[model samples]
Target: NRCEYCGDENGPFEIHHVRKLKDVSKGTEKWKQLMIQRKRKTLVLCKTCHTDLHRGTLPDNRFAA
Candidate 1:
């Protein structure tokens, strides 16, 4: 698959979310929403891109610095 960030064609791509459901809701709501939004809401990204996205380094980084 092609990575959503860098367009790298690689094996074992991961699902990258715009906003993690757990970050929005908690407990039961988190699980329910996550399950419902798992597929259509994620982008396919490579390992490096996935790590950067959550590591407070990428341009679209989601983690707190």
Candidate 2:
């Protein structure tokens, strides 16, 4: 597989949620409402690519947060 963002080899890549789970899981019906309302996105990324995305060093991509 290839890193969805950079097109680099994605060996043992991980599925990453665009939005943080903690924020997604707020504490009430609002959370459920948000889940229902929003189109949650995820990415299949290699460890290095994943790290870069979080560190804000990589250009944004559709698959990345």
Candidate 3:
């Protein structure tokens, strides 16, 4: 399979989230908004991109304009 974020076809991959455990009733964050819009909680991502995500190092364009 490929990473949903980086499109990396790598094994030993990790899912960003398993389910929407936290609240998103009034989420203004891009990621949270994306999740709400898509009605999906999971994001298949490579290790590198996943780390960059948690670190908030990913570029704003990653989410697109």
Candidate 4:
């Protein structure tokens, strides 16, 4: 499977979830916005992407991080 955020075809992936619309809106990151725009509650991220997301930094969608 590939990462939903970074398009990584590797393993060690993590699923990041946002349960609340308000909480999702509070985030301005591209990934977060994507989740909101698609009306999804989860994002499958590679290790690097997951780390970047927690650090408030993530690369653009469908890019290799």
RMSD values, in order shown: 8.3, 7.9, 3.3, 2.4
Over 1-65, each residue of candidate 3 has an lDDT whose tens digit, in order, gives 77666567864577777355356536665656666776777877778767887897855456532
**Model 2 segments more than 4 A misplaced:** 20-40, 60-65
Clashing pairs in 2: none
lDDT, candidate 1, 1-65, per-residue tens = 57655667764688866565455344343222443455445667678767765674555332121
lDDT (tens digit, per residue) of candidate 4 on 1-65: 77887677876899888777678887767887878887888888888888988887676654543
As for candidate 1, its clashing pairs are: none
The lDDT values for all models are: 0.54, 0.54, 0.65, 0.78
Q: Top model by TM-score, which number?
A: 4
Clashes of each: 0, 0, 0, 0
Model 4, which residues run further than 4 Å from truth? 61-65
Ranking by TM-score: 4, 3, 1, 2
Candidate 2: residue 19 lDDT (0-100): 60
lDDT of 2 by residue, 1-65 (tens): 77655566736686667465455455343322334355455556777766765675644443432
lDDT of 3 at 10: 63
After the best TM-score superposition of candidate 3, give how far the Cα of residue 5 lies from its true spot, in angstroms: 0.9
**What is the alpha-carbon lDDT for the whole of candidate 4?**
0.78
